[model samples]
Target: MDLAFGADDSKKRKGPSKNWTEREIEEELKKLDAKIEDAKTNSGDVEVRDAILDKAMFLKQEARDYPEAEKVFREAYVKSGGASKKMELLFEILLMNIEKFDIDSVKKDVTLCKQLVDEGADWDKKNKLKIFEGVYCMLIRDLKRAAELFMSSIATFTCVELMEYKDFVFYTVVTAMVTQDRKTIRKEVVHSPDILAVIRDIPFLRQYMESFYNCEYKQFFEAFVEIIDAIKRDKYLQTHANYFIKEMRLVAYRQYLESFKSVTIENMARAFGVQPDFIDKELSNFIYIGKINCKIDKVSGVIESNRPNKKAELFTNTIKSGDALLNRIQKLARALDI
Candidate 1:
């Protein structure tokens, strides 16, 4: 008759048990736990502790146990005294737990960031904190808090030469809020004076000033100055009347042609880059001389030309006059400068 243990007993005697159940695995884990504790107590064996913590963090995350993962990460972070790698790990873990973490928890992270700041972490790390604060405040629509954080970060780098260019970007953000309604024309807008001061001091800012002023005042200042110069040179002196008229007509024609499908006296004057009254006078003279076959549309305030031959004579006369007029203006400019 066979013995009760039989083949299983023989197998167990020959080697380790092959049919180990969950209970046996648990018992083995308990023995490994004691060994881990012994290693932790050994003053020089930090590698084992780090390895164990790494394994724990990995397992917690892989098992989708965020709370446990975060707990292990925090312990690692604290043990490392907020090392850069540790901070990065903390950031990743916290971001994953954002839905479960409340504002208070985020604020705790912020506090940890402050601690890192106090511990003399790198400026880039501090900037990262500021950026996080800014983004969080923006998400909550807390514009004031966001602005404060941005200003603080700006201040931190203000003394550094490399960061000086950021002043313009910072000022732009602040001034946008200061000058909200340009249409109503508030003389007290903070941005206006600052911009004017910048324009006065910075040579390269001339074009920028022109664009800024055009947007704010709805007037092209440089173009207006050119128009004034044209008027002073064109009228009151018949020396270059023909040249001036031609110059004005060509400009007006090009302007009207380019801007609109149709032309008008006022629009033509605008295109000529001169006062409307001046354009009207010149056109009337052309009509009187039978140089241009044109009709004035009273309804649209436009001058329509029907004869292309008239344009040729008018163009020739205008060119002759414009040359003489430009020469005189140049002489006058030189005399004034002298």
Candidate 2:
């Protein structure tokens, strides 16, 4: 599915509505509207919900009336019966709404969907929601949580309605690379049989992950450029392309720097397949922000790792966190001292 990189592998657009003319679609939608009225008149709630669902789908696909479609979808959900029925109907509603990427609405609907699933929804339904929610998390820039959700659902991916299996694998691997630690990425993404099965089909993405893992910085940098292009083209990731690219470059640079107390700037550039000046400028910005924890010797043209001692860093962070918490508590106490 290389969903972010290219066209979707297959969409669950079930109907000839797309092939029909506007007038033809309008005529067919009118017929479905009549069917909905007939179901309300002579059939059960299930029949009415089914009829409304049909109309909603028609509006979404044929008429291209998303607002109307969503309204009708809500009608179907309202008519839906029991936990299972509501779960099914809600997922339908979710798919339509998620396409719009209305962030606040998605958050609320996903939360509601979670609640419904918790009320004993089937395993299949639960797994499906995980993928949807994972995609939603990715869209919102919560890469860590999105990676967690995506990795958890890989073996049981059945969200064909949401995306193709290969696309799911793509999202899972990309997010894992950025947000997951090396050991976790090795365990959950690099060596996962489910991911390995189709990863080669996504050649650049495979290179992006595997090259970094294998310490092939040259290959990783080559793949990184291709991936940035794909991310720029992706509707879901376009907004985050610059951010993602910068982060990934840092991932490569940090990994390379971790192995050396000091490395010549020219050597570091050669390793990343970039120019010495480019590496110097890149490392300077990161070092200024304390992002890379490194020092650059301009005259000697050497880059030095200034990473703090792990235990000392950890202790400093703990004390800072505790002091911040205590200040907040003291502030509260002073306000209530009366």
Candidate 3:
């Protein structure tokens, strides 16, 4: 497992297996098989355990036989003695599962990684684990945590094996825009030196962040429209594209409407670079579904903010989430009891 990811141009990151010819692959596997068979007697040796794990990586990266590879990986973990060695092998297994997008396995493996990390892994290892956890979160569409992890790891990012640095920033901005409030976005993201360094290279992404925070509604709408296709085509985000877009729109609309008690429909439409009729229909639909807290004066073509009490809303949300968590725990306990 080559984890030397100290490169600015992570584009050259490629698995060694990709370069091996079919004949070479077959020859290498045969050699590894002999070594593995022989190493079984000397399995207590650290070097023998490493060779066993190497064979596991070969199966994972080349043969793509996940079950067998995972079996070998777990066997290697059980035989391995050193904490560092265990963590290294764990990362190998985690990355292999991640490539396959095996969400359930990822969740299980990440929990183990957390245990290993907490016991002895250094700060660098912990930061790298954040990248792994962040990627797992993305696969599961838990973008809020994913955003937080990515943002925190930006300055010390070394997960180019999972995704390039630029792509990491892209995910950070995309998730943060919908999940973070204006103040946090301004402080953590807009002012982030790591984000600012690479944001210009990505198309429409900078505008997407700046316009929203700066209250440039028309630019924000245009930037969002420009980037919508990319979001829809994304591997991790595409599944949640509709949800993400709707949340973003609600955020933008709420931000704008929160500034005023009442605003004319025509002004709102003009602000967003859309027709009044379009705005009317969109707002009506959002309001009807309780996505936005605002009332429309159809006769006067005005939209009035019906913002709820912030403290009450926070308390209600906390209670609801707590109840949901308790329900899940109870169900899991019942399942275990069986």
Candidate 4:
């Protein structure tokens, strides 16, 4: 499976797959339908029905009939009344339906997975479920939660042998960058030698991590663009490219704000290679959302950074020191009396 996403700029992430001949597909579907009908008619066992449906789903998937596979998986999962094996099948359905980018189905499956975890599902299954849930959050533009979830699953990724390990690590780094959560990266990603080894080999991921960590905003943006370009060809990621771009831009904006006292929107835009109005709009959004402690002067077209109140901070620190000294003196006096 060549999951190495191409830099395809097309918005349509999927194309027809000639996995099976039409006649072969029709023959398999007919056989699976008869089997399913017989199972329903002769067997009252829900497991038997679910196994038959699963076989039908496999045939659909083999024929690259993703929509039909999704339908069959959903029916089997629901009709089985939450069987454990069906939950695994449901995850397959989630993977197959990525082109549709259905948030509702993802959420429903996440809820079911959480319930399964609570009921003592294996740690490996729980870890995979968490990663999938993080993907759901990313698709929904919840970058902060996505970063947290990805970071929390780092240990699992280290111990587990996942076929999609490359995508998992790539998204982990991407989500952390989008949210600008360096502390989490430092703790969860950088310190883990296992993940570090994997990332060091991948040029783009390595560049992203180094650029972000080294405060090379321009390099970071360039590498980010490359990442986004590659992601655009992926069936699951293309749907959220715009949102991902917006979040990554905010990260760059935040980094720039930290280094300068104030900067004109035009100048910042020029530095970032974007339009002045786009930078202004982003700065305005950050201010509105309380994501950045800054003020935008619309008339001057500059964003002024909100410096901390050093005087107030000094006074608070002085008070804390005084209280600490007084406590020490009291302890000394008690010792002397004793």
lDDT string, candidate 1, 1-338, tens digits: 11111112222222233555557645754554565566677744455456446544443433445676677666656556444555555554545443343556766776776776787776676765764554344334454555556545543433221112223323233322222333322232223444345434333233323433343212333433333343234211123334433643433333234434447777666644567777677667766766555666667778776555668889999999999999999999999999
Model 4, residue 40: what's the lDDT? 74
lDDT of each: 0.47, 0.83, 0.82, 0.71
Per-candidate TM equals 0.33, 0.90, 0.84, 0.66
- Sort order, lDDT high to low: 2, 3, 4, 1
* Candidate 4 displacement at residue 269 in angstroms: 9.9
> Which of 2 and 3 is the better model by TM-score?
2
User: Compared to the true structure, candidate 2 yields what TM-score?
Assistant: 0.90
Looking at model 1, residue 51 earns an lDDT score of: 49
Tens-place lDDT per residue, model 2, 306-331, is 88899998999999999999999999
Best by TM-score: 2
Q: Which stretches of candidate 4 lie over 4 Å from their true place?
A: 1-23, 33-54, 78-83, 158-163, 231-234, 259-304, 308-338
Candidate 1 local lDDT, residue 121: 72
Candidate 2 — worst ten consecutive residues by lDDT sum?
1-10
Q: Please list the residue runs of candidate 3 whose C-alpha ends up more than 4 Å from where it truly belongs after superposition.
A: 1-13, 16-27, 40-44, 309-338
**Candidate 1 residue runs with Cα over 4 Å from true position:** 1-45, 59-61, 82-89, 99-101, 147-338
Clash list (residue pairs), candidate 4 = none
